[model samples]
Target: MVTNIAKAILSVLLAAVVSGCALGISEIPVAELEKRYASNPPLYIDVDGLQVHYREEGKDNDHTLVMLHGILASLHNWEVWSRELAGRYRVISLDLPGHGLTGPANFEYNTENYIQFINSFASRLGLEKFTLVGNSLGGYFAWNYAIRYPQQVEKLVLIDTAGFPLKKIPFPVRAFTAPLLGEISMHFTPRIASSILLREVYAEPSRISEAMTERYYELQLRPGNRRASQTLFKRNLEILRQEPSGLEQLTMPTLLMWGEQDHWIPADPHLKRWQQALPHAKVVIYPDAGHMPMEEIPVRSARNLHQFLSGAEITDTSE
Candidate 1:
């Protein structure tokens, strides 16, 4: 009887283990992801031994605009903006190392390394001077790149950019930074979690489509992408701890585009900080948008950018 009871207990435990294993999310192969995600055959360039994935449109135009996406975001974030602005100005967008199709490389994922990657990428493409635009973490890189290569950056546009001290990281992102929890959390990325994150970033959660959420979830499962995010998140925390130094010194034409509904990084305080630092910079605040105004309100945001580039007077549209 004792032996039979022991066997029954073991069987129950084994069944529970199998059920847990079935629930775990598997990593999506890069090739399969490329098939589903890549709208075109995707272009890549050799930058610092990394085959950087990039897209260039409106190559014939005189002015070049290089755009970058935020953490866990790919160049696809700029699809609407790229299409809208490409006709007017040459638009180039790329998947920075460890994000999108460009998976993890040997280089350390830090601010300096990211800045160098931007410089090297621009040089490899024979781009001498271009307007640099970035969103979220990409904004951090954009401004830093402009500071390091001020002469090379003709103009700088920061869309809900980072680098200013964050009072608190949004919970979804902060969860991925905890030591043990981060590693475990990476393996169980659910589709709904992606949807939740997308909702958090958009002012109107109702606007988030099924396809958009699916894409984010699929890309997060790209092999090694989660691990890279973990590393990047830790590095970013380090960045937030240090004081931001060179905003006032950036004397080039600067444009600050913010979303009034940005909960991840409140628009009011950050906007105040930026305005104080860049008194002469033009500011455009989208009232009904969230963290990513480019994705949320592409038409209006792009129009503001076009106006700024054309040297037209920007009527304050915050109201």
Candidate 2:
């Protein structure tokens, strides 16, 4: 009887250990992220009765680079590039409604809503014309914005964007996109969930550092971000589904960059579509990189961007 009791205790302990490990896998402590990057206090702009938060770096009235980040991400994603590009071009990175320091939009979170957000952001900043650079969902917004306000856009750069709907989405996104299931899942997500998200953002998982994961986690926990993200996730399909055929309509010099190993939105079909639609647009596929090419291949990505912005001749067009 004593031996049986000991075995039972050991079984209970083993179960607890397994559960703890699962919970700990992605948890990133919020305090650590805040310790690393001091929150650049937000400048609020009243847009459609909601306060929108944004950070403006570099000189105003210069040629501008307006950066839009991906889904579930914040303007902080562009920290590396903003510093590099600020000297040459005024850089404006803002938290999109329903993400980062910015809370949910008073209106819907669709393409039209985002375009309005972009317009409001630019007009408030007094920008006449600017280069637009976006990643993932931002990539979608960049293209959409360029199409709607062609004259306002001087140049376009799409980094691992997600405008065209793929037949299959990444498992995590699919989980989050599901109706009631997504809502239920959000409640149970632990701190380590951020690391899992970071892992998905990169083609090379090893590139995701502890510090980066922590930053992403803290940003997610900021005031209204979690609930807003959940709502955005549920509505993403509707928003992304309405992708306009603006590739042919855009005349601005365009650069399309992608990670060849991207599992989130695979390269072949999307690349092929873009190439066929925008025959004049330049395309570059980074072999070792995954979904987030800017993060995965920042140096090369930055170089390509600089060259493209400088009007250097691009050689790669073959599909």
Candidate 3:
């Protein structure tokens, strides 16, 4: 009877092992992913002890447009805007500390670290001052950087910025911002999830294409990218409080753009606070767009940006 009991115990242990294995993450070949995704040859620089990758385009003699992209997004996301704006101005976009071709460094992925890197990056590039433009997380950095280094930012553009305390945070954002919960997803490759998340950001789902999915998937798997992502998301919840505290200090000429259908950040409540804080701000709301107006409706947004940058009073085109 004792022998039979021992055999039963072994069977139960094996069952438990199988059950755990059932939830194991699938293995992907990083080599194959990189071959297709790492297409762009990047210009390199050493900023804040990190080897940074960036793309510099447009005329050297023209005024500069220094662009920053959102969380988990790379310099590639600004490809369309950079191309369109480069014709008129010097356009430079960089992969943030832990995003894109740029590898991770030993620093907290918080606003302070990002702002320091931005300052160092501009100084290295000999950019005394330039128009600062950012989307989502990048926008949060842009506005704050304006406050911190008002001397270095000539103008400010915020696209669905994330500096305020969100009244109703989205499911994916809430999940990834939770400490242990988000880190758990770090082990899994994000190719499929990237597509899903991209879909979530757009009012029209078809905008999440195969090419976009491939790029986001492979770039995210870059060494240390996944871990940095978890750290940034968890730390972002902490920064939201710190972000709004100094909005009044950002007195630069500002342009605020929002997607009316933005699920990530609603336009109505936040815009009111932004206007209250920066009384010298201009606001535009896009009717048929979502979180990513720069991508969702690039040309129309371009018209607006071009007007604003040219010091022309911007007319609302949402009607």
Residue-level lDDT tens digits of model 2 in 167-198? 77655566566664455444445445676666
Model 1, 227-246: lDDT tens per residue? 88888888778686566888
The TM-score-based order of candidates, best leading, equals 1, 3, 2
Model 1 C-alpha lDDT versus the unseen true structure: 0.84
Global CA lDDT computed for model 2: 0.73
How many angstroms is residue 282 displaced in model 1 relative to the true structure, after the best TM-score fit?
Answer: 0.1
Alpha carbon lDDT of residue 123, candidate 3?
A: 96
Query: What CA RMSD would candidate 3 show?
Result: 8.1
Per-residue lDDT over 7-41 for candidate 3, one digit per residue giving the tens place of the 0 to 100 score:
35435444645566432344335455445544355
RMSD of 2: 7.4
lDDT, candidate 2, at 143: 92
Instruction: List the lowest-lDDT window of 10 residues for candidate 3.
Output: 1-10
In order, candidate lDDTs are 0.84, 0.73, 0.77
